[model samples]
Target: MTQNRRWRRVLIALFVVVIAFTGYHAVRTVSDAIYWNAHRDEPIERWMTIGYVAHSYHVPPHVLHQALNLPPMPDRRPLGRIARESGRSMNQIEAKLKYAIVHARPPYPAPGPPPRPFMPSPSSSSPAK
Candidate 1:
């Protein structure tokens, strides 16, 4: 009976820990979603990387690279580093990113009518009477 009680206590503790862990993450996820949604249109900054800017501003990374005349790749470097390496000012980089964001096309084309379902044509053979 004592062993069973100890096992029960252990299971209860484990269950509590699991619940706490899940609750913490759930709260964090909701808070982050709210924060990002609120700041979705925030301006890009020099400290941000290409991927970060792309995600924050809803602009494609390729558009940003094209605007900045950089090779198409996953550039992990921050904008400040990129500007410094390319001998350009931060303002120039910011301007190019802004332009690209302003002119960036929608990632997907406009939805069109649903495709018609395929139907086999009626056979030329007559049905037996």
Candidate 2:
């Protein structure tokens, strides 16, 4: 009887430990997700960083990634390698790129269609010159 009780106690302890672990992980995941959603910014930061490097070097993504020191940000695939190789920091590259694009956008074209005065057609009532 004692042995059976001890085994049962061990099983219960193991079950409790597993339940506790599972609950902890579940709570952690939920909290992390909530935080991420709350703080997430819409614009993708990694691409912006990589794009900055590309603009600076006048090269493709592979070449840029072949050049800076950027963290492993998702969507920065080929460019990350270039940036790390080139020793250019991702933050600096991103800043420069953002500034350039924002400043470079052309102003809206003149509001309305071109102004053309109406002229009577020669085909209707007017005689051909």
Candidate 3:
């Protein structure tokens, strides 16, 4: 009986570990899918809008997307109206065409090294590194 209990405990621990791993990778996998989509056949205007909105709000790209309400507005709708409705700032509005909303995939970084893996070391990140 003790042996059975021990094995069961181990099995439970293993299952929990697997679940944690899946949760972590699932986030990365979904993000990577978006990153790839942005790079694949996406127009220059769409890419520029993300950078413009993100910088204007002083927020990360993901937050900017969330702020704008993802999946984008219909092409026919004006960006200015959407921005005003969403309570976004003028700089962000200027970043996008007069009033156009694009799809939600994150923008691809211009010619540069691929996104570096997250490092726990503070010095390894930022200019301080």
List runs of model 3 lying over 4 Å from the truth: 40-129
- Which candidate number maximizes TM-score? 1
Q: lDDT tens digits, residues 10-75, model 2? A: 999999999999999999999988875653223435444555444443444443333333343424
Specify the poorest-scoring 10-residue window by lDDT in model 3: 96-105
lDDT of model 3 at position 45:
38
TM-score of 3: 0.29
TM-score of each: 0.76, 0.40, 0.29
> Which scores higher on TM-score, 2 or 3?
2
Cα error, residue 126 of model 2, in Å, equals 63
Q: Cα deviation in Å at residue 8, candidate 3?
A: 0.7
How far off is model 1, as Cα RMSD?
7.4
Residue 18 lDDT in model 2? 100
Q: Rank by lDDT, descending?
A: 1, 3, 2
Candidate 3 lDDT, 1-129, residue by residue in tens: 999999999999999999999999999999988875566433323224654544443445554445555554323334455566768765665544323333344456689888999768875665842
State the displacement of the C-alpha of residue 104, model 3, in Å, after optimal TM-score superposition.
27
lDDT of model 2, residue 15: 100
Predictions: Cα RMSD each: 7.4, 14.9, 15.9
Clashing pairs in 1: none
**Can you write out model 1's per-residue Cα lDDT over 23-104, one digit (the tens) per residue?**
9999999999998888676777878998888888887899999999999999999999999999999999999888888889
